[model samples]
Target: MEDFLVNINGTLLKGPEAKISVFDRGFLYGDSVYEATRTFNKRPFRIDQHIDRLFLSAEKISLEPTYSKEVILSEVLKTIEAAPFKDATIRIVLTRGTNSDLGLDPALSGPNNLVVFTKEIKPNPAWWITDGVSMIFFQKKIEASGSLPKTGNYQENILANREATSRGAYDSFMINTHGHVTEGTTSNAWVIKNNILFTPPLADGVLDGLTRKALLEMAKRQMLPLPLVEKSLTKDDFLSADECFITSTTRNVVPVTKIESHLIGNGKPGALTLKLLELYLEFVK
Candidate 1:
């Protein structure tokens, strides 16, 4: 069994001992905001960006953080120092705390903060990178229109991702009610078409990912001449894309060689996908 260090409130606990009340609104009602980050060569990548996003998510969900950004940042460093794994992923979860039995009102909920010890990222698979993964178009749409911000209501993702796995797919591409391919179950979607990178607009209801932001910057720096196009995409458009990939904290960049039965550009990772992955890795290192 592996050991882990967990922080509940401000106290650190060994694996198997960390606990929160069952009445926590976050657990009972999914009223929580969270962030995931990976370390490169034992150093956290984009720590500031991740923390900033965490705060933004918490604010969106109305969770009052008891600690300031400086405090949380220090805590994250402490967690890394105590961890056994040199290279690891860090998960910071902030719950809306426990609600008074009087009612389920978030207004009365207390704060529930937890930091978990993490380890080496278990990237999808070698084949996922070399041969690329496949995606299934889920009939389900990621939360469409009218922004929910960061309510942490992830049930849709839970159900859709489970469906994807049950169907033997690596991930699911969640379309919106408007029929635009928005994002993946846990990653942001990007498509390469006619040598340009295209992704669903923020209006399409996808989480603005840190890696996505970085990629956009890289594209600008290289003067790639390729536009980071943002527009609604239909299933047919995705099927015909020259290449497709998803980005997130874990899978830095993973190509999608197929969508359902439609083969993605010769059924292999595209040249642009490889270049982007290399550039991203170099940026971190």
Candidate 2:
């Protein structure tokens, strides 16, 4: 814990030494944008893409970052270098700065603030990659945001995940108010059937995950006969799926062998799922 590194406004400090103002809009209101970048062999993987998404999210929320892109990239590298672990999970947070009053007005807000934190990356169990995971679905419509803004205001996911926990599942799927399959509590969902990979389009309010994008590219480059389709998905589609999985920055490709009462494809990690995962890992390295 003492070796953990944190960068607050370009100042490298210990995690315990880092602090932010209470009046910061990120604290008072959910006025912030963030990106989670993971490392492979101690180097950031696809960091450019993550930075692009971070800037996009900040633009969407009108949160101006004090540090330019170059500063961000350099500072992030420095923070990563300060970490003792060979692999890490790097999180960059840009807040709307602090304010004197509690008003929602941006003009009243102070200058933007940036925080970069690094911690040792913990690998998921070997069984998780082989046996996969189980999940439950809950219905709740969220209007799709194309860039997939992963903001601090993710209370919906928190509640949905709690629902999954009560049901003894690792994660849960959220169906939007429009009665469509949106995504997982914190990941993008994919259904593999008949050798085709199907997932919700960006219009469905699904986060355009960096890992998901990379996997799609890997699928194409490898010329794996499987076709990647981005379309609206439903419970019925999953109920008949041969295999299902979720993708995220930290978790990578996680097989979803079970959903609610239905068993997916003999209730095991499908062959194709494992193959794609192998290819994905190679791509990251």
Candidate 3:
């Protein structure tokens, strides 16, 4: 079994053998929509939602996919199945194909190029979950609007994460121009105050993360005492919260112990955050 696999259009190839044209808009202008789905117990988790979001992203960017959603889904499953790992990450990318002319106009583009690949899942450091991760406030602004689709453009996030790492932090929480804490570099940010869950609203331009959606659903069905409120949050709010956490596809729910110099609560994963993580794990099972 191969450690990695790539499916270009309908052809499967080893990861090192996979290739795309340099003239492809996805490489040149980041003109692409993509989705990342991870497997649990050798089976895909929330694959339908991921694929749906992929189509939604394509629609938002006005980039028509070369294949139907069903076809894309089938291709993703096929690639994952061909991978060697018991648990893996599957990435589906749809890029505007190479243009006849070296121009920025979409009209010059050809058919979309669909690429699906699978790789081994990399878990977060044990300390990240056991002791919680330290985060810093990234003052730099992200150029992409939160409402935009999950496209190939990620320069801003890359820079933010780099800055965070340089500053000796696990990740960075980006603040908008208005001083509102939008989100983490790649995850959805959340804070618990007085037992109430607070996160930036989608209206604030934050991506509608699937993990965030799942958490909200779980919270509602479990009927938590306080309702999970979606509101515009500021850095001060996060720093002063009783507990803090972030959610993503790979890292489901991780506690945030410190933000900058301030220690959140007791500086360890709070009870509520741990409880929620337990519930989330059970939900995943």
Write one digit per residue (lDDT tens) for candidate 1, span 39-96. 7767987989888888888887667787678888888888787777677788887777
Looking at candidate 2, the ten consecutive residues that score lowest on lDDT are: 139-148
- The backbone clash count of each candidate, in order, is 0, 4, 1
Model 3: residue 29 alpha-carbon error in angstroms: 0.3
Cα lDDT tens digits, model 2, 1-285, are 565689988898988888889998889988898888888868997898888888888877777777688888998998888778778989999888888898999998878888998988889878787778988988764565454687878878999999999999988888876777878988889999898999888887778898889877866786555889888888889889999999888888899888997889999998888887887887788
Lowest summed lDDT window (length 10), candidate 1: 141-150
Of candidates 3 and 2, the better by lDDT: 3
Which segments of candidate 3 are over 4 A away from where they belong?
140-146, 223-226
* TM-score of every model versus the real structure: 0.92, 0.95, 0.94
Candidate 3 lDDT over 140-246, as tens digits, reads 56544456479898777788899889989999998877778888988999999998999998777788899999988977797454569899999899999999999
Candidate order by TM-score, decreasing, is 2, 3, 1
Task: Show pairs that collide, candidate 2.
Answer: 140-176, 141-176, 141-177, 144-205
Overall lDDT per candidate, in order of appearance: 0.79, 0.84, 0.86
Q: Evaluate residue 144 in candidate 1 and report its C-alpha lDDT on the 0 to 100 scale.
A: 66
